[model samples]
Target: MVNISSCECMPWYVGVFRIRQRLTEEHWFDANCKYYTHVFDKTIISQVLGAIKYLSTIPKYEKCAKWLNENKQNLSQYFLEGFKSSKPLEVLIHGDCWTNNLLFKYNSKNTPVDLRLVDLQVSRLASPGSDINYFVYTSLTGDTRSKYFHDLLEAYYQSFSKVLILSRRKLPFTFKELEDDVERTKIVGLVIGLLAIPGIFFEGEDEIFDFGEMTEENMEEIFH
Candidate 1:
């Protein structure tokens, strides 16, 4: 069973959200744009679309694939510009909150007693929902997520509330607002899963293409 308390730690440092402006201008925008351009030479978008098309052929991913296909155009826009739409209740989030990026500590009985997040390189200001959605979608099985979605949200909010009370601070937003934010930004999870989960699970011995050797010419070959 996935421990819900593992997610409670996300909102512990509310002060991090206050530094959004400097981080956005000095770090996220520059790094994100340069990453999309210079790293993949602007071919990452096409590769993502190709990956989505490939995913649509998988039986287990049919529903997710349908949603990805339907919203692909918006997803392309979000790839670079999603930060612009951050809500007023935004917080500094673990920008890459997938399964591999999280670490859990188990007690003597092997029950997860603690959690730690890794890879702070991509951390940025965004809705707490962004992290929640990404982690829930990418880490949990669909049935698990469907069963415990509300419980997870409740646990997260309770944790956030306890932290705020201990820090003598006001609740930044109501639970309803959090739910709305999660609803609005659910696409962040789906889009990220579409781009990442395939590569993580790919077991083919063939080298897809070296990032160092990537070019517009060979980028399309990744989907083949």
Candidate 2:
């Protein structure tokens, strides 16, 4: 068996865009309309749609109820639409950016030296937020997220901007634009978090799962 020591791990989402730019410019693949589609199953989409609709009916989500009720019918499509973007800004992203797909190596002083990402099979060309949302929402705790969210975003923007400069391409959008896109497409993470947090974290393996577990109490306690 191979033994690997745990290390600090943070995703470099900019590398994904950099690599895709190189591949497309070099004519490795048709970058026009061709992109990785079908990141998740229709059944999963249906389930999350159902969950969102259920959330709307709860008293806790009353503020969101208006929007959810208005959009539940098309919630699945909206979730999928979050994966798309203009060709200039689009790139291959590790669609599944959750913890299991990542590993890191550390120096003797416990500083992270390298990050290794596995499970490239689900990678796709999409908006930058596709990977960002997945990694941030899934990996970070509530306190850590609140504390470092701004700094983390700034770091990503700097790295991505540097890559764009190296590629000799004009920055397609400003840092604020990226921030707005993340906020707009946040539903993707919201849906995934809804399913992942309650199902995977709270429910024990031997326990029977219940739909009711997707409650405000559970979400606030577990997610926050």
Candidate 3:
């Protein structure tokens, strides 16, 4: 596998403006809309917003809910700019690292022996932790993530460290630093999961929603 942590060069065509447009305009939020707008499916946007609004009602997440509500308009912009603000270690990352984008090949014994990542359109230069956080939060169950979070970090660090050594590149960051990066970039995972997971399961043509029919009350019901 390539030592992604050490690789610095990106394609000549990939520029900051393109990354900004992808993050701000094409993917999550529509810049033209005054309110928070999801670019892909309006129904999915409603569900995500409804979920956020629902969370705000709960006492425990009040602070989180408050922050999200206060910053809803700027959330997409924040996500785009966050890469530049706190990146101690940078690497080319598979921007969308969810389970569906991954394909695994199994041996005769039914054990997986090989892996491939698809959907390169969103790939960009960013912290390696962004990919890790996105994968674990979106792909794995909450229970699994909570229990094996540290173990997962350790495994990734060991593998990455080995690759760097083999390639004669100095290790860029310590294991602790990796953990910190993961923690710092975790909102990327959470935001993505909230936005994308609903659309993943609502696949049937019959389940398609009429955007005109959506309202505050029914939106929460749809999310539930």
Candidate 4:
């Protein structure tokens, strides 16, 4: 993690960014936090993109062309070994995510103030969908759930992919490689398999999944 000094450009955002930079799920936090934190902080959406941008900038992906001159050691291929589906970006991801694991508390005025991501037991280098699919699965719909889900994820993907445009000339993979990532979900049951964990289906009133949403379109949009 970069020092707070690095974020001097934006002081108010310092605490949020510093915490995210220093904390990797690799080292366990104190047990005081019971939920497994997969992510932390209300990362500025732009800053999240900034972190991914750093990855794309570190090495040129075009080295794949020369075969011998490749900067990365066929790194994407190594990561793909475990997956039966295609990939997009060969990027690092939160790996584990779902609404239940994310902890958010609004301030006194009911404004969002803190975000503590929990459950990193499975964080890994995987498709961005690894994170996105989880949210799609776990996020609760209010009377207007689908509207938010589609809007938020598309906003995420658009911002996430912006950095790659600069890497266009050196991109190692083909259009098909990227498209395959989104297409893989078209196969039945995959997204659900990733999201339908036992923890999310807890029994009893304390475990109720209800969020009191109304509107058939909202429900339909979530599953659609």
Top candidate on TM-score is 1
Local distance difference test, per candidate?
0.64, 0.60, 0.60, 0.38
Enumerate clash totals for all models, in the order shown: 0, 0, 0, 7
Between candidates 1 and 3, name the one with more favorable TM-score: 1
TM-score for each candidate, following the candidate numbering: 0.74, 0.66, 0.67, 0.41
Q: lDDT by residue for model 2 over 5-116, one digit each (tens)?
A: 2212342544534466456432213223322122233334445555667777778786675665566555556666776777665666777777667666778897666677
Q: Work out how many backbone clashes candidate 4 has.
A: 7
Off by over 4 Å in 1: 1-27, 31-71, 79-87, 215-224
Q: Candidate 3 residues 1-224, lDDT tens each? A: 11222111111112222233324332322335633344323434444566677887788988876676666665665455444323447666668877687666667786555566679787666676677777777777777777667876776677666666765767777988878887788777766776767667796967766757767666556544
Residue 4 C-alpha lDDT in model 1 = 48
Q: Which prediction has more favorable TM-score, 1 or 4?
A: 1
Q: What is the lDDT of residue 97 in candidate 1?
A: 75
- Please identify model 2 stretches exceeding 4 Å from their true place: 1-13, 24-71, 202-224
The predicted structure with the larger lDDT, 3 or 4, is: 3
Q: Which of the predicted structures, 2 or 4, would earn the higher lDDT when compared with the native?
A: 2
Q: Whole-model lDDT for model 4 versus the true structure?
A: 0.38
Q: Write the per-residue lDDT of candidate 1 for residues 92-198, one digit (tens) a residue.
A: 77778776876777788866665677887878766677777888888777877887789878877777777667667777789999898888777677667666666
Question: Which candidate comes out best when scored by lDDT?
Answer: 1
Model 2: which ten-residue window has the lowest total lDDT?
A: 1-10
Per-residue lDDT tens digits for candidate 4, residues 60-158, read: 743433332231232222223322323334444444554555565566775555456577565544454444444444454333334354455444444
